[model samples]
Target chain A: MKILVIIPAYNEEENIVNTVTTLKEKCPDVDYVIINDCSTDRTEKICEKNGFNYISLPINLGIGGGIQTGYRYAYKNGYDVAVQFDGDGQHNAEYIHDLVKPIEAGEADMVIGSRFIEKKGFQTSSMRRAGIGVLGFVLRICGGGKITDATSGFRATSREVTKFFSANYAQDYPEPESIIAASVSGFKIKEVPVIMNDRTAGVSSISPFKSVYYMIKVTLAILIYRLVGKKWR
Target chain B: MMTDLFRMILLGGVLIYIIVIGVLMKKGKMNLKYSLVWFLTGIVLLICAAFPGIIRSFAKLIGVYSEVNVVFFLGVCFLLIIILSLTSIVSLQSERIRSLTQTQALLEKRVRDLEEKNEVH
Candidate 1:
């Protein structure tokens, strides 16, 4: 099965080389592309220096838009599956095959690399954990599925979902909301246990100060999607 | 008939607003889609100034206590609607920009690949 790993990056110059090298070593069979979300730093220079396959956006489209760009490319290129691997060095490239296996087997339309299924390795901060728990509960009730890691960015999608996401995707705070959207639209989602590492370089865009706001916004987005999301036949 | 001073002032104000919108449109400072709304608003204001009795009767019909109150209420509502429309416009513009950026990047990559193939040839 043809697979594409989509690395959505913004201002991640420090970690970009390590992340790409790790992917090259670990997931050589999988074709990968980096969507540089108009990083102000030297990320584009690094990508060019490495001769990595990358797309440097003229404007910063944020994470959601960057990932969607990858989806669009995957859809156009006729990739059977597209996996979102974070560029912040938190997500492991080694788990890419595991994330894509369910989709490859036709057992699921999407597979999420979940940290909480086995509850091993860098579970994030306590406050964020609580927020994720709350989101999990809400998704279960509204989306009619048990998502252990609603906010996990390490996920894979089949061609059907890749095309769908290319057309319409949630913007800011997209991870949790996207799950709800997929569920409501009658897509099967599965989570696999995967260990994640702490980001070795660069501060996260979502600061501790914004965690509360993030929680509130993502929760509201999920709920709103439940109301407005269209069900597929 | 309303007082001459009030009528003249309202007429002049509405005329000035229309002129400003026209100038903005001519200067390409405003999108036609958005300027249409403001143009309609200016026309409505002009109509109201031309015939205060229309507003008065409409106010009485709507059970507004005073004609002036109806005018103020209508003004506030128009402003709110304009703000809402502006937000919608902004959202659409951002969406378009995102699509353009993604398409541009994809095309650039394709061009680079083709150039590399040509060099090899």
Candidate 2:
């Protein structure tokens, strides 16, 4: 399958190159694109110097917009599958195949890489895990399936999903929301076990105080999607 | 009971507001799509100001004790509708802007790739 790995980077100059280099060494044949979200830092310069394939957005659209740009590229370029790999060093490159296998086999429309399924690697903090657990329960009850990791950025989607996301996607903190969108739109989702590493450099955009808001907002977003009863497709 | 001078001031104020909106529309400072709402609002207010008896009867029909309350109610409702419509407009414009940015970035990369291929040849 023609798979495109999308790396959404925002002010990730410290980790972008290493992440891309690791992906190149690990998955040599897979095409990849880095979406530079108008970083105030030198992330774009590093990509240019390395002769990496990237799109530098004119303005910052946050993570959701950056990923949507990648989906658009994949759709327009006739890619059969698109994998979302974080530009930060948190996501391991070796497990990318595990996420894509289901999509390639036509068993699933969207495949999410979950850390909780295997209970391996950096499992995140207890507080964050609790929040993720809450989101998982909410998705299971409302989204009609059990998604162990609703917040996992490491995922692969078939061309149908790539086209859907290219036309419409949530703006900020869209990981959980996108899952809800896919499920309500009648796309089958699957989860595979994958080990994740703690971000080696740079701070996460979500701080301790914001996590509470994130949980509340994401839960409300998922519930609204379930209740809206609109034909998303 | 409003004095004659107060009613005259209200009439003049609404007239001036309508004229200003018309001037803005003519100068292209405001889009016709948006100006139509404001213009209609101004006209409604002008009619109310010109015929105070109309408001008094409507207020009476609605069981409102004071005619001024009717004026305030209509004003608030009009403003609320205008604000809601503006919010929808902004939401649509932002979506369009995002799509434009993504397309522009993709096209720029395609051009760069073509240029590099020419250079290699």
Candidate 3:
């Protein structure tokens, strides 16, 4: 299959080199592109230095817009499958195959790398875990089920879904929210048992304050979207 | 006659909007606070346009007389504040709306994906 790996990054110059090196070593044949969302840091320079194929936006478009750009590239180039990788090196290359297997087999429209699905060694804070649980409850109410890993960043998509997400992807903390958009547009999704490793270098974008803010904002958004999201569809 | 005709047409359109908002209220499309704002804003603008002379009288009563500069300054300030308020209303929901939509979409897509995987198995 013509697989395309899309890495949406923001100020991860420190971890990106190792991240790309590992992915390349693990899957040499797969095509990969990094969308460097306007970073004031050395992210773009580092990508160029490593000779990795990438697109650098003039201004930071956040996660949603960055991923949409990747989807668009995949759709235009006719990739049979596409995957989203993190710049922080939190995603394990060992699981890339596991994440992509369903899409390659035509079993899943999209496959997510779930940290909680296999109960691997990775651990998050208790407060964050509770926040994810709350979000899980909200998703269940809206979509009629539950996911052990509601906010996993690693995922793969089929050709049909690449076009869909390219046309419409979320920005600013998009992992969990994107599932609903895909579902509404008539795409399939699956979660695989995979381990997400700890970040090798650099800091995570999410903080305690941002987490609370994210929870409140995203919850309100769900209520509002349930009321008016159909207009766009 | 042409001016009157144009005014009537515009008024008809505004009145239609007011009616639509009213129906939305009945359907629970809008809550009490927003409904009140839309209702009052619609009425006030319509009244101001319908009676243009009210502007001069009101301006004079506000102690500006017919002084164009004072009235213009105050009008500009009011317009600026109104624009700022509208922007806030839009931005207040931007991040929240975005996250909510994404989360909801993720849930729906995940189920569909899992079902498809099962089919292949």
Better of 2 and 3 by TM-score: 2
Worst 10 residues of 3 chain A by lDDT: A224-233
Per-residue lDDT of model 1, residues A25-110, tens digit only = 99889999999999999999999989999988988888999999999999999999999999989999889999999998999999
Two-chain DockQ for each candidate model: 0.81, 0.80, 0.04
Q: CA lDDT of B79 in candidate 3?
A: 62
True contacts kept of 3: 0.00
The C-alpha lDDT values of all candidates are 0.90, 0.90, 0.74
Per candidate, the number of residue pairs that clash is 0, 0, 19
Q: Which consecutive 10 residues in model 1 chain A have the weakest lDDT in total? A: A224-233
**Candidate 1: stretches off by over 4 Å:** B1-4
lDDT of 2 by residue, A23-126 (tens): 99999989999999999999999999999999999988889988999999999999999999999998998988888899888999999999999999999999
For residue A205, give model 2's deviation from the true position in Å: 1.5
Q: Model 2 residue B76 lDDT?
A: 88
What shift in Å separates residue A161 of candidate 2 from its native position after superposition? 0.5
Best by DockQ: 1
Write the number of the candidate with greater lDDT, choosing between 2 and 3. 2
lDDT of 3 by residue, B4-121 (tens): 5645765786699789999999999987765675676567556644764665577667776553344345446656665776688787676456444434433443464577689999
* Candidates 1 and 2 compared by DockQ, better number: 1
Instruction: Give me the runs in candidate 3 sitting further than 4 Å from their true place.
Output: A231-233, B1-121
Residue B43's lDDT within candidate 3 is 75
